[model samples]
Target: MIKNGEEKPTTNPVTAPYRYEISAEQCRSCDRCKKACKAGAIRGERGQAAYLIDEEK
Candidate 1:
């Protein structure tokens, strides 16, 4: 039975995946992750790079 305000435990393998947010200071404009990403969800501008969620995915 479940109780109110209780959370269910889950570890399903099919669940959505998450990405680690790299620090901006650490970014040397390497663009390695951008090239690595097949989804093309990364873009660089203004001397800084960021990961964007591509609608295609």
Candidate 2:
């Protein structure tokens, strides 16, 4: 088969797993962000530094 002025479509390649981070100093630890995350990825005590677990997400 021959094509004239036609090209095939391309797809975006998959990239590395996404990494989430939170600033412990900046975080107020209000628990609002944790509550919003339905995936339960955020873990840590209230009024303390919170960590984001990639596996939990």
Candidate 3:
């Protein structure tokens, strides 16, 4: 209820799971962990990879 003018939602949007970064320097570029990430939060560039909870996730 709003005296001025407002709307309210009953539920919040579902957020994807969080991803923590693994040491890129230690990453072997095998992509094994990347394949294992069900959330598709793992991304790589130039042989160095990182895990992030981006919009794609």
Candidate 4:
């Protein structure tokens, strides 16, 4: 029911989940990671001991 060059459609597709995390205790609060984050997921005060991460971002 198909031509020689025809291709079959995929019924299911595989996807990789997006993953990111920040270690509050290990973080030096250098603000480097916050600046690099394009999604603005990282939030905290400058020179603070810890930072926060927004998973929904």
Q: Compute each candidate's TM-score over C-alphas.
A: 0.48, 0.52, 0.44, 0.64
- Measured over all alpha carbons after superposition, the RMSD of each candidate to the real structure, in angstroms, is 9.0, 7.1, 8.3, 6.6
Ranking by lDDT: 4, 2, 1, 3
Candidate 1 runs further than 4 Å off: 1-12, 45-57
Instruction: Report residue 41 deviation for candidate 1 (angstroms).
Output: 0.5
Tens digits of lDDT, candidate 4, 2-53: 3344585544344676787777668898999999999999899889778888
For model 3, residues 1-57, the per-residue Cα lDDT tens digits are 223335554444556755476774677776776778787877665355544334556
Top-down TM-score ranking: 4, 2, 1, 3
Query: Residue 37 in candidate 4 has what lDDT?
Result: 93
Which has the greatest lDDT? 4
On lDDT, who's better, 1 or 4?
Answer: 4
Q: Between which residue pairs do clashes occur in model 1?
A: none
The window of 10 residues in a row where model 2 has the poorest summed lDDT is 1-10
lDDT of 2 by residue, 1-57 (tens): 333456655444555766667886678878887888778887777877655555655
Question: Of the candidates numbered 1 and 4, which has the greater TM-score value?
Answer: 4
Over 4 Å off, model 3: 1-19, 45-56
- What residue pairs clash in candidate 4, if any at all? none
Positional deviation of 43 in candidate 2, in angstroms?
0.9
